[model samples]
Target: MDVPGPERRLAAVLAADMVGFSRLMEADETGTLARLKTHRIELIDPAIAKNRGRIIKTTGDGMLVEFHSIVDAVLCATEVQHRMMRRNSDVSPARWIQFRIGINLGDVIVEGDDIFGDGVNVAARLETLAEPGGICVSSAVRDQLGERLDGVEFEDIGEQIVKNIARPIRVFRVRLQQDARSPPDKMADTVAQIGRKPSIAVLPLVNMSGDQEQEFFADGLTEDVITELSRFHDLLVISRNSSFVYKGKAVKVQEVARELGVDYLLEGSVRKVGDRIRVTVQLIDAESDRHIWAERYDRKLEDVFAIQDEITCAIVATMAGRVEAATHDRAKRKPTDNMAAYECVLAAKVLHHRSAREDNAQALRLLDRALALDPNYAHAHAWKGCVLGQTWVYNWCEDRDATFQQVAAELETALALDDNDSDVHRILAAVNLNREDHDKAAYHQERALALNPNYDLIVVQQGELLTWLGLPEEGIDWIKKAMRLNPYHPERFWNHLGRACYCAEKYAEAAEAFSRITRPDHTHHAFLAATFAQMGSAVAAAAHAAEVVKREPGFTVATYLATQHYKREIDRRRHEAGLLKAGLPA
Candidate 1:
C-alpha cells in the first residue's frame, strides 16, 4: 500500500550509527550483530519510547527516529547513551559498542513510510561528524531545544562541507560529563569545603514565527530572562554571545554540559502573530537530557514582560528551590507601570543588542520614546546608558564625548533610582572605563560581579578594564577565567584576550588567541593584524590589515584606538603606539 502523492512537512530527524561497525563485524560479524540487537532492545528502544520518539527505520548498524519535539529527540539520545554506557561498564572494553547520533529539525519530504530531502542528509552528515559515543546536532535541532537543558556544552565544529549539500552545514558537538559520587567525609576536621554551585546556560530563544522580523522579540525576551535570572547570586548565567552561538543548531545536552560546564539548560521558542504571542519554555537536566519542567504561555503583546517574569521565576524556583523566594519576589517588580513604555524599552534593547549603527540609532530613539512615556523608568534609563555607551564604543556616533556624557548622565540617574540593578552598575563601569577612571570602573565592575558573579560579560569587561589600567598580566588572567567560564564566547571576547596578550608581550599567545576567532569583525581584524605584526608575521599582518581596511576604509591606528572609547589617555596612546609599531599607519 504505497501512496503515490508527495507529503512535505517540517519534522525533527534523529539519525544514529554504530562507531567502528565494519571493524567489529570483521572481527565477529554474528556476535557484533547479536550485541547490537541486544543493546537496541535493552537500551535504545525503551529510551526512545520514554522520550516519545517513533523509530522510523533501521539500517543494520544505524537507526532513524522521528520526533514531534526536538526536546524528545535530544532526551532520547542522552538516555540511549547513558544506558549504553551503563551496559558497557561490565563488558570488556574492546567488545563494547558505541554509537554516534545526530539530530536535525527541518522540512522533510515524506512519501508514505519513507523520508527524503536535505533534512535527512543533514542528520546523516551530523552523525558522521559525531565522535564515537558522542552526539552531533544541526543548528535547527539546537534552536528547538532552547535553554531548557542546563550544563550541556556545545563545541562549534563550524561549517561542514557535506556531500550533495549546496551550502556548508553548521555542526556542534555536545559535551556530557559523568557526575562523581562521593562518600561522606569522616576525617575532614579542617576548613569546610563549599562545593561549586550548579550552573546553567540559556540558549537564545528561537523565533519560530516564520517571519524574520520577529527575531528581535524572541532575542529580547531571552535577554530579559538572562538578566532576571542573573539577579540570583547562586546561579551562573552564560552571556548572550556564548549561548547564542548555538543559535539555529541541533545540539546534544551532554556536549553542551562539557563545553560550557553548565549543569542545566533553558530553551524556548516564541511564535508571534500581531497582538498575540505564544511562548514555549522547557528546563532540562543537561546530564540526562530529561525535561525537569516545561511550560507554554499565550499572552497579549503587552503582557510579554509578565510572561518573561513568570518563566524566569519558575526557572529560578526550580534551581535554588525555596531559597530563591526573595529573588523571585524581587523579580516581580515591574520596570514601568506603563505597558507602552515597557514595550518601547523592549524594542530599544532588541535594537541595541544588534550592535549595528542604524540599529543603535533606532534603539536610542526608542529608548528616548520610552523615557518620554515614563520619565522615572529606572530600567529604561539603564538601557539608555547602555545604548549611548555602545554607540560611542562601536563608532555609531560622531560626537563620542556627547555620547559618553549621555551615558554618564543616564547611568547616574538609573543608579540613583535603582542602585541594586546589576545592569546599571555594569553600564556605569563601561562609562567609567571609557573615561579612563580605572578606580571607578573597577568599583562598578566589582559591584556588578558581586551582584552576579556568573555574569560572563561583566567578567570580560572587568578583564578589559584591568588591561586598560596597565595590569596586562592580571587582565589576561581575568580574561582567561572568563573564557573558562564561557568557552564559546563571541569573537569580541577572544579579540580582547588577544589584545591583553599583546599588551603582556605574549605575541605567540596573542596570535593563537586571535586565530581562535573565525568571525573577524573590524576589531578582530585590527587585533589580528596587530598580533601578527607583533609575532613578526608581516605577511599575516598584511592580510588582516587588508581585511581591516576593507571593513573601515579610513581605518588607522589612531581611528581604531579612538573607536575603542578607552577613557584613559595613557591606555589609548599605548594601544595606538603598539598598533603603529605593528605596522599600522597613524
Candidate 2:
C-alpha cells in the first residue's frame, strides 16, 4: 500500500461560480447553461484574455483560471462584472446570470490535470465568502490593487474561521461602482468651508549643485524646515512622505493642489560649492499656482544653518501672518536674523541627509558648532537631537541608549528655549513613539500637525504612528492624503503605504503599493515575495525570494523583527506581521 507520491508547483487560482446556478438550472437548465455559455464566449473569456489570464478548467457552473499578475486578475474581475452588467441590462433579475468570484495565489499540488491543496482550497472558500454578484479576496489580492483602481471600496470582514482550516483567514469584500464624477466647481464654497486653519505642503527642494551627491543636502534641508513648521499646532502642514513624492519633478501648482488637497505649496532650491552656499525659496498659492513670497540667501559655508533658520522663520511668519491677518487679529513673531547659527544647522542638514555613520558624525559635529555659536538656537538643537535619534535607531551608533538619552536632553533644552517651536515638539513626539509611548506620540504629533497643517513629513509620521497604534483605517487615510500632496515622492512612501494596507489586511492594495517601487531591497523584496505567495503566485514569490535571500542571507524571523523599528511600537508590530503573513521568514 506504499504507492503514493505528489506533484507540486506555485500558481494563482481564480474561482468564479454562478451566484444562483442551481436555482436557475432548476428553473431552466438548458436556458441558463445556454446564456452562461454565451456570456463566457462573448464577454468573460475575452476580458480575461485581454488581461492576460489563462483559463485552467471550467465546471458546468464555474470556471478556474490563473493570471501572471494580480493586477490582471483584478482588471479581469472588474471587466467581467462590468460586461455582465451591460449584458444583463435588458434581462430580468431572475434570468440574469450573476457570479461570485474569489482569487488566491500560493503553492499547490497538481495531480493528473487537477489542482489540490491549500491554494485551491482557499480560493474555493473565498468564493463562498463572496456576496452574490460581488468579489471577495484574501488580503493578498487586496495589496496588489493599490490606487490604480479608483472608486472601488473595500470592507474588512475580519478573520474568517473557515471549515477545515487550522488558522483563521482574513477576508475583504470589494465594492465596484461606476467611476466617481468630478466635483462641481465649488471654489468659493471650498474656500468658505476652509476652517481658519491653513494647510500647506513643502515640496522637496531642488538640488542645483550640478552634482547628484548634493541632493541629499537639499532634501535634508527641506525635511528639517517641514519638521520645524509642523510644530505650529494650528497649521495643517502636509506629511513628509507625501511631500517628498514631488522630489526632482517639475509639477504645476494647481495640479499639486488638486492632488494634495492643500491650499499652499513651498518650493526651494539649494546650491553649494567649496566654502559657499546659495539657497532660494518661494511660497505659492496652490490653487492658482501663484507665488506669494520669494527669497534668496547667499552666505559662506560656515553660516549655512543660520540662513536656513532665518529663511524658515521668515517663511513661517509670512505664511502664518497672512492667514491670521485674513481670519483674525494677531501680531506675527519674528526670529533674530543671526547668520552664524543658521549656517551650522544648514551644514548639519547636509550631513544628516546622507544617512550614513560618517555623515551622522559630521551632522553631530556641525550641530555642536551651531550650539557653540548660539545656545538658544532651539531649531538647531531639536534637529540635532532628531538626527541622533535616527542614527541610534539605524544602528549607526554603538551606544544607542546613551545617544537616545542625549537626544532627549537636547529636545528638552529646545522645548525649554521655545515652547511653541513645532519642530522641537515633532522630534519629541518621534522620541516618545520610539519609547513605545503611543499616547504621548499621538498627542505631540497632533499638536505638530495643528501648528503647521501643511507639513507633509509630520502627516506621514502621524499616519505611521496611527498604523502602529492599530488604527490602520485612519493611517491609510493620512498616508493617502500625504501621497495626494506629493505624488512624485520617493519609493519609500509607497512602501509605507503598502505596510499600512497590509496591516489593515488589505492585501491586494498592499501588493499594488509595493509594486510601485521600481527597485526594492531585502525587506521590500521580502514583502513582495510574501504578498505574491499569499496570492498564490509561486513564480513571482520565488523570484522575490531569491532577491531577499541574496540581500539578506540567513534571514529569519529575528532578522525580520529587527527591521520593524518604526517610530511607533504598534506600527512596528503591524509591519512585521504583514511581512510574516506574506510568507517572509518572520
| TM-score of each candidate structure, all chains considered together | 0.42, 0.42
* RMSD in Å for all candidates: 26.2, 24.7
Worst 10 residues of 1 by lDDT: 186-195
**Candidate 1 residues 102-154, lDDT tens each?**
98998889877888887888898889888878899998777766688765657
Q: Which numbered prediction scores highest in TM-score against the true structure?
A: 1
Name the regions of candidate 2 deviating beyond 4 angstroms: 1-339, 350-362, 486-491, 515-519, 562-583
Error of 1 at 25 (Å): 76
Per-residue lDDT of candidate 2, residues 150-244 (tens digit): 66677788999888878888898877663336544554455343223457899999988897866766777788777766655446788899998
